[model samples]
Target: MNTENAKPQQRFLPPPPGAEYPLMGSAVGGGSYNSHLVAGVLFIGLAAIGAIDWWLVAWIDGCLAIGLLLDRRTMNRKIALRAMPGQMLLYSQVALRAAVHMFPYYAFAFVLYLGMAPVVLPLNFAISSFVMLYGFYMLLRVYWLVHYLWVLNFRWEHAGRTFQTHQANLKTRRSAIQHVLWAFFLGNVGLVVRCSSQVITIAGFEYLRQSLNLDLTQHPTLNVHVMSIFWGTVVVWLATFWFMLQPTFLIYYRVHRTFHSCRPLYDSVHSIHHRGVLPTQLDSGTISPLEFALTEYNLPAGMLVPNWYWTLGQIILAFAGHLPSHDTNTWMKTGHHHLLHHRLFNVNFGLIAREDKRYGSFYCEPPQAASAPEPSGEAAPPARRRHAVAALAGEDD
Candidate 1:
């Protein structure tokens, strides 16, 4: 089979017309365009408003709900027009994908409302609105989950043999029980620990304040000024990128070693992610449960700032900036990098290009052209090339 010229299968249709690219350029490279300007402005406006009046969080939630509805309509139209497969199963998958994408925002809004609710009547209206909106979001998520499970069960029953063969070929060795246990433990238990630590820290601080006869209402270190909040959020966002590097390196190295070593347990888990040769937005979450715990679940766990507002800002940044990076082919290198990773497994192993570069493992497919590049007089020393090969070999030992 000649695989070089083979066209990759498409999973989801291209992102709906306007929501294709990240609002801002890639964090690694500063390249911005007009297409995402409206999204950028809207996100900034919402963040600014949120800082001044927490009540506006409800309005922000309303906007997100509207966006989700618009996305659903777009997907429905695609199905109706036969732009993509419109199987009843596909509809359920699309709905589940949307719910999964929107879950973070819904969870963030709920937390924002909990923290920002004021006793005054004017704000009480906002609180009421948030409560109602959150209730709807929860119900919708529940409905989506139920239908998703039913779809899974139906597919399992009807296509059990085929599905099992494909899954086995993918090299995923984890049993259903193991996957569920790891997913629950890492997803739920890790989240519980992270959230509880924050609560416990705050409670401990409050106890100290009361014992020392300090003002209960005053935050000792937090600068609640609007600009401070904005800048602080920015700092936290930047720091999050750096903080995630360690875990990204760990996950990549582990997977790379497992791939090379041909160990059944590790290879099976890692190969699940590699199954998506032509990746879609949905592929981002399509990983072994254990892999999910080690990678995506750990990305946000390193956050040092404990403020709910900071958490909300991170969610907004993720939705507004990072999520779209997965959908479109833009200057944002993430989508391109990930696509390359799927197609050319050994090259571009790190989450960010810099990691690959520092370890001398960076590799990208050369552009197709009629002429080759003119040879440079200077070439990398032999030792450097050897080191690069070793790094690419995942030689932690």
Candidate 2:
């Protein structure tokens, strides 16, 4: 059941020759055997993000994921199980593309960040909070787009087309206690990692409160040019990157042949999640009751910090906000890693593993939508429904 001939549904960019249908079936061993190195590296990144500073860790994560995904031209090369000199060169080129693509925007945001809070110090809280949340939505948008096109729609059973039917139900099968533990541990991890930055920031600014108290006329000296925009933009930027790929981590525990098959894609675990290609507000932390607590893992401290009495509680808020709305990858866009993990035994191993580059999947297939019309609409007979825009319509390909 080689799924590799399925053709590409929609590419973020033009794929290399064979990527169109790289995985078709359950071929256990071949030149296709996936490497676990990427998975190991990702987990290492996760542990670092959890163990050290979330801000720096998240920035590195964003640079790498965005670097990898946005650089679709070289995905086949860099993400491959075996790295050749040719692949290394391709990776360098892709990295250059990513720098060209993401840096200016990063700089603009960075420039604005320094000035944003300083000019609006009195209003920094309100502005920063909203910007951060909005930024998250954008990240998830990319997540949704990638997952929808590349990962979910290419299943061997469906074999190379998008599923139009709306999906429902995303229940998890683990015990109540397990769910509780998952939520509690993961949430605590997120809260501590993501929120600690704020605690540190506050510590840096601890003198502000005192300065204002000691001399009402001597307001804290906040550099309007450098630090202002950073106040709001940095948080938004980090939140977007940190959470956008989080589902990658959580989904790992549920799936993976190395672990137990506690969940499946077409079933409750991921079905409801894949219902929409364009995720909206409802999609935020929208998992089942058993998994609801997982949402709290990625929350930013800005929202709840003001309401809490202890500074540590504010820190906790920042940490809890790491999941849910925080994730940039939506079920529609970048959930391929999770979805593939279910439908096929190999490939798409969440954020941790991407065996797809090596072996392809059991259902390695993607083709023009079955409803694809000829370039000249006149060449094609009129159908009952208008053709849906392709997955790669706006993509680089």
Candidate 3:
């Protein structure tokens, strides 16, 4: 064979017909594939023979496993892989969405951890208690201000159709009262559980760790449990955005369907929320206590995870989603999905996923005008000037 004309021998196995070969480089091999393999084998040997802590060995192996998962270089390839322009653009969009969604949860978790971690036990308890109750008012105020600004800025471009005239109604006023009181009560209970977890981690971590016999390494000068609590909470939020959110959306789809289809439950509990024929920002918080508890299931995780900050982050994230969903101005991207649910009670239940379509409940058609039936029990109050606080509370003014 002429040397110039000799074809290079194929290095990688051909992919199955019609399958697109991944062009990205493997995260592992792009670094030092042999080096990782040697190190991993050495660590496993050390762990198996009791020369090293098993927990430490496991951690290193976990990191190596993640590296292998991320590496794309191992994919069948005949040439050096480079990301295509379209692929790069898609990755950038995914990065931006993850940052926008997860930043707030991580920020809240950090703040709660920094605030409570250093305070003395009883004082920390008091502070967290204050955060749980008083934090709602602050959150509501901030949401109201931000939403008002958003509506003002985007009203010209993205405003959605409104169902009812914006007015203060007696029924909404009464609903607002129950909303505040219910939040106050539930907040206290939730924070108590969260704070108790923090106290236990601070005072009894060693005992608890030994009792559970979990495979976690101890830090020389720090409480590993405390570290895990904060970092674990942060990691959960990160994972939620990067991997878990879509699946979680499926779960909520079932939850919403159940709440809506069960007439006894809806009439007794969930109806308080449906009362908002045209939900406004304030109506976001005007849900019955039981419903609020059901929706905010993450807060209850403190019992198992002993992560107070996780619970606090959950509170922040819940209100962040709820407030915007109720904004009939449709400022946020997904606002119309829930807003449609309020108008056409039989449809548009799940938040982000099109599960309603899959399950035969999807309905996106809106009437030409606000034709939602009026609340049956209370007479609609006349439009009237009201106090600023009353306006913030979601009462018609």
Compared with the true structure, all predictions reach lDDT values of: 0.34, 0.31, 0.40
Worst 10 residues of 2 by lDDT: 27-36
Task: For residue 85, give model 2's deviation from the true position in Å.
Answer: 6.4
Question: TM-scores of the models, in the given order?
Answer: 0.33, 0.26, 0.40
* Top candidate (TM-score): 3
| TM-score for candidate 3, residues paired by index | 0.40
Predicted model with the maximum lDDT: 3
C-alpha positional error of residue 170 in candidate 1 after TM-score superposition, expressed in Å: 15
Backbone clashes counted, model 1: 0
- Candidate 2 local distance difference test against the native: 0.31
Candidate 2's C-alpha runs over 4 A off are 1-40, 46-80, 84-89, 119-397
Give the TM-score ranking, best first. 3, 1, 2
Comparing 1 with 3 on TM-score, the higher-scoring candidate is 3
